[model samples]
Structures are given as structure tokens and as C-alpha cells.
Target: MTNLLQTERLIIRSWIPERDAEQAFVIYNDPEVTHFLGKSSRVTSIESQRQRLIEGIERMHQRNNGTGSWAIVEKESTTIVGTIILKQLPDKDGLPTQDYEVGWHLRRASWGKGYATEAGQVMLNYGFSVLNLPVIYAVVKPENHASIRVTQRLGMKPIGRTNKYYGIELLLFQLDAPVKIEESSS
Candidate 1:
């Protein structure tokens, strides 16, 4: 249940509502950040967001498999810049698709910094290593070129588009578990 992970310059840790709600509100409220996220508008109140954050944490903990949204913190500043998520998405039939997804959302100020890709790589590593998944997936809005690039940097290839996610069509990208090669000796 402990899902703390580290990268060269970032610390990916579990979401604590009390500690993260304010920063999360700022990230979630930014229209530019939420534009591709499918949120209708900015979150208006910290109280409401706190409720949502509580629920989000509960859902992740419910999974009980170290899969959930975690705060993306700057190692030097100790600031919560954004979140990186690894979780399962339901299929069209409302059953588990058995597909784990990797995604990131950062504050506008934090954009253009390679944090998303940095955090994403570790999450993918954890998914494949700790979780032992066969393949991981990402669904991005077509117009969000920045995120598309992150997925590309993660070496995720576009499989296709589908409306199965959140009832809307999205560009699907996937990365398979790395195949190991063995040395042959004469």
C-alpha cells in the first residue's frame, strides 16, 4: 500500500488530502491544464476539491496494489508540481479492461520541463516490474500535443482511437513489457 517512488529530481508519493488539496486545487483549476482533462471548468472551492481528493485517495487505496495518483514533487523545492497516475481503466462493458494506464498532469508553470516524462518512466517501470503487467496504456486527447509527445518519449506507440474511455473517443497509445535477450555462447 505504500507507493512512494523516486526519480532523479522528483519524488512520487501518495496523495495526502490535507497536504495536497490546495496545490491540487491550483493544478486542477487551471483551464490550460484541465482543457484536455475533460473537466468542464475550474474547481471553485478547496472544500469541494478536498472531498474529491478524499474520494480519489480512497479509490486508489481500494485497489490496494500500489496503483493510484501520486503527487509529483520537486526534489529541491519540495513542492507538489503535479500528479502521475497508474491505474486500471474499465472496458466498454463496465468490467475491468485489465489494462493499466500511465498518465501525468502538471501545473502550467511546470510545463515544458521534462517532469512528466521523468515521472512517467518510473511509473511505467513500477507497473512492469512491481505490478508485473504485460502492457501499459495511455489515452490522450488528440489536440494535446505536449502530452502526446510525452507518450512518444515513453516509447508508447499509438495503437488506435477509441470511445471506450470515459465515453469519448481518445487516441490510444501502448507500451509493452520489454523483452529480454539472452547471450548465446559457443
Candidate 2:
């Protein structure tokens, strides 16, 4: 699998063993970032976090054939900002499904800068074009206006509402492949 994917101002790439633990701690520790996520159980050690990252990578490989949560980095500084995940979840029918779900979280400092939207678009394109997914879904807390706005910007429309993994209410949005336009030669 390719190590890096470039966007206008960001680089979406696989996590390196060296950086996995540090990044995991950032996500697990930040309250503001983890608010909608329910808890703030900071990863105590880099090693454990690294192990989790390794396992996550392995699961992604096993399931999706090589695509999963990508570390989001700034292009200029190459600093790890956050993560973008294309997770696979089961459908209501209790059967294995192939829906692509998009999610993101960044440091407080990175909020309000349009980075989420920018990175999200790249992932959405990859989902539809590279992954050839028919639809991409996003689940956000009803009160997560920031994420709701990001999903809207990506052309995702609200599909329904449901209880999330942690039993919290969530709003579901989806974006399907854009309709192709044909030109007439007169």
C-alpha cells in the first residue's frame, strides 16, 4: 500500500510505528476532541498505543484489503494533526456490509481552519474513485455542529438518526456517487 496521499494542504498517510503511540495519546487524551466520543482515557504508554495501531492496521488489511485510518499531517510542517478513518460497520440486517464511513478528529489548535473539510474531501474521493464505493456515510453526534457542517460541505445529506456504539444518539449522513452528465454534440 502507498504510504502517503497528498491533498492541497494535507498529507493522508499510514501511521509509522514511531508516531503511532504519540498520535494515539493525543486523540485519547484530548477532552474537547473526545467529547462526542464519550471518554477521555488517555493512553498511558506509547508502546500500548503502538500495539493498538499495529492491530488496527492488521484489521484494516484483513478486512478492506489495505485501507483504514490514515494519519493526517500538515503538508508544510509534516506534523501529525489527527486521523481520518474509513471504518466498516455492520448493517441493520446483522450481515457484513461494505459501507465506507468517514470520521475525523484534530487538535484544538487545528479546529476552525477547514483542515477537516479539506482532508475529508480527499478521503471521500478516494472512497468513491479508488475504493469504488457507491456511498460514503458519516455518523456524528446530534450536537456536533462542527462535524455536521463538514459533512454538509462534502455533499452528504442527512439520511437518518440512530443510536451509536456507546448508546448515544447520532445523526447519519451519506454521499452517493455524483450523477454523470453527458454532453450532446449538435
Candidate 3:
């Protein structure tokens, strides 16, 4: 959708595979980073990542909604540090539901720098304010304390573990939209 979102310290924008693939590969190919994301999400080579991102970018455009993945960039350094996503949640049992998820994935170097939380906060604003979604959910693996803490920082409340999404048990968190979206002059 070419929507550019900004936080005080980060920029969230669309993926340019040619420019973003290398750094994205470093994150997706790292065992430590991908451990909580599941085995199928791993990238084997830069070429594969480039191809995947190219396809992903196309799918994102086709969806044409505000929901999809966005590249997270560090403001000062102008480096891509991660991705923040707000998208439809895949149903585990072929049931229809209005479940959308908000998530973040930061490179190891960007971890603990509050970038994830910053990007997440902005995306929440976009989802609730721009998209007018009633609520947004976050699904985190139980042991992914870092991500869980980010959700807490974003003001999401735990709704207990469930296998209703992704066909696996995950700790679910939810946040209902505020009465009104906060208006900003920027």
C-alpha cells in the first residue's frame, strides 16, 4: 500500500527486496532468530530470500489492505533492523473469523533497543486508527519472553494459550481499540 509509518526512532515501510534482502536474510537465516518463528520460516540463501520477499511484496500489494508486513528501519543509522506485521490470522480449523495479528521480528543487533516496541506501537495506531479494526491480537510462543514483553509494552493483555491459530498452541494477547485514535500533526 506504500504506507510509510514513523515512530520517534524507527521507520516502517514497504519492502524493497533488492535493498532489504541481505539484512533480512541475516535475520531469517539465523537460528537464534528463527527458533521461535518455526522451522518452515527459515531462509536458506540470499537468493531464496530475495525471491521470497519479491513474492511477498507482490502478495502484499494484491491484498491492498493496510494489513501485511512492513520493514522496520532504524532512524539514525538508516538500516533495516526488522519487520512489523499486522495481518489476518490463519485459522487452525478452517473456520471463518475476524482475527488479525500484530507481531514484530528484530535482528539480533536490534534486540533490546526498544525498536520492536516502537514499531509495534506505531503499527497499532495504524491498525486501530487507520484501518478501524475493532481489536488486534498477538500470538507469541510461551517461551518467547522478549516478544511477550513487547506485547505488554504495547498494552496488550494476555488471553491465555490457545490452538485456535496457526494450528499450534500459543499464548494469546489482545487489545481493543480506544474510543478514538490519537490524532497526530505529523
Q: Indicate which candidate wins on TM-score.
A: 3
lDDT of 2 by residue, 109-171 (tens): 788889989999988888777877788889888899999999998889998787643345578
Candidate-wise lDDT, in order? 0.87, 0.78, 0.89
- Taking all chains together, the TM-score of candidate 2 against the true structure is 0.84
Clashes of each: 0, 0, 0
Root-mean-square deviation (CA) per prediction: 2.5, 3.1, 3.7
Residue 20 of model 2 has an lDDT of 61
Cα error, candidate 1, residue 159 (Å): 1.1
- Per-residue lDDT over 39-77 for candidate 1, one digit per residue giving the tens place of the 0 to 100 score: 653677888777778998898768798788888999899
TM of each candidate vs. truth: 0.91, 0.84, 0.92
Kindly list the per-residue Cα lDDT of model 3 for residues 54-77, writing each as its tens digit: 998887788788678888988899
Deviation of model 2 at 126, angstroms = 0.5
- 1 versus 2: better TM-score goes to: 1
- Assess the local accuracy of residue 74 in candidate 3 as a C-alpha lDDT between 0 and 100: 86
